[model samples]
Target: MTGPGLRREVRAGWSLFRRDMLKFRRERARIVSSLLQPIMFLGIFGLGLKNVLGGTGPFQELDYIQYIFPGVIGINVLGISMSTGVTIVADREFGFLREVLVAPISRLTIALGKVASGVATAMFQVAILLLLSPLLGLTPGFVQIVLLMSAVALLAIATSALGVLMASRIRSVESFQYVFQFMLFPLFFLSGAFFVLDRVPPWIAFIANLNPLTYAIDLFRHILYGDIELGELSRSLLLVNSPAEDILIIAVISVVLLSASVVSFVRME
Candidate 1:
């Protein structure tokens, strides 16, 4: 993996990355729709529930908007990263994917480049959300924001890999959309984004523990809520896993999914 061969592979991956970013930039409607859903959840739903959750128990005295802010960000990243698979289907339909598959580069490099592009797009959306955090009453410190973004980048890698895996053999955009929606809603809802894991039934909690986004959202909470004062019950309800455990789980999942995506891409026609 050295010499001119290595250099050529790098260039190929870079080309793919650049082309995807440019395509994403040109899709203004996609950019707006991607950011819009999360904002609505954070604003309308959070505020609506703020009063309802104020009375007692774990949610007592909780600032619902501030509490679910990280969760909204998690859902945003989840949807955007996993939806990158849709682009692969589009490329396939237009024969662009076939052209790339025949190119002189390892499938590993191609997969990595695609995952990187998806991660870049998801993070771009996250940066916008972070900028609007203050308006949403979440004034995280500069250091906290940096750490949170870094954590989220790791999460994005795994999710984008999953997207690549999903799109690997699918040839139709219509089929991809149906499958994407089927998985997207369950993953987002079960990830503890809109509800507390502790409040769910044992069976549901068991299922959530298996979700990668669960760990990612918990990791986000650790970074974003580090400075905020929270009650014991609130902490219990929010931080599902310790930061160290969350990192370990997400890192392993990312490695496994990345490897799987590369294998799937290589096997694709």
Candidate 2:
């Protein structure tokens, strides 16, 4: 604790990551349930809606399932990653987090560790969805596959930071549910997950542009389609700016939220 160094942080992060993974292994039912819900959404909602809606627009030539695969992956990342905050609350209520708080490490290290573990679990779920995408008519190239994975990692990190920030603020389970409902739905709806941003109203478009999840969805969509450049949407009248710009904004937000969360956790201790 005398001086924070790269090696110290990495070691601390890995230790916490391993501990959380072990806890998750013990709660296998919860893990499976969390993963299954998204898979069901992909199968029922994506496939079922495809039957009714038909095909994607000019910008996207993929089938319904393929088009939404990116969005589905983003959703899984957002949902599972943000839920890690609840584990912190549970740890606090059960007195386990108190011991961790007193440990000889920076609170930032602890927060990073928790976020890393959550991201890992979320990535696992995303990978499963990707593997099953072929049945949904997705035949992404090797490059698209790599880009998709990178996008998932970025999203997982951003969402996890937001979760840590929320967990630091909320003190009870009931309040957590209320906040989760208030925050999660709006993020998903405004993210252009279910529809194109151009199809929405101007006011809603403005809000969607501001949502970090919007950048995430756009990034995934850009990679999946391989025909459209996400940066163009950002440059157009929709006022999304550029893909790099959105990436920078998201990165800044993640860092700020994460730093604030770590400060709050340390203060609480």
CA RMSD per model (angstroms): 1.3, 3.5
Query: How high a TM-score does candidate 1 get?
Result: 0.96
Q: What is the Cα-based lDDT of residue 160 in candidate 1?
A: 94
User: Over the stretch 47-82, how does candidate 2's per-residue lDDT look in tens digits?
Assistant: 788877664343234456665666777878888888
| Model 1 poorest ten-residue lDDT run | 54-63
Clashing pairs in 1: none
Candidate 1, residues 1-269, lDDT tens digits: the string is 98999999999999999998998999999999989998899878788987887555656645778778888888888889888888888988988887998887898898889899889998999999998877766678989988898888999999999999989977799998898888888888888887787768888888788888899989998998777778887788778788999999999999999889989988887
lDDT of 1: 0.86
Q: TM-scores for all candidates?
A: 0.96, 0.86
- Against the unseen true structure, what C-alpha lDDT does each candidate score? 0.86, 0.75
Clashes of each: 0, 1
> Against the true structure, candidate 2 has what lDDT?
0.75
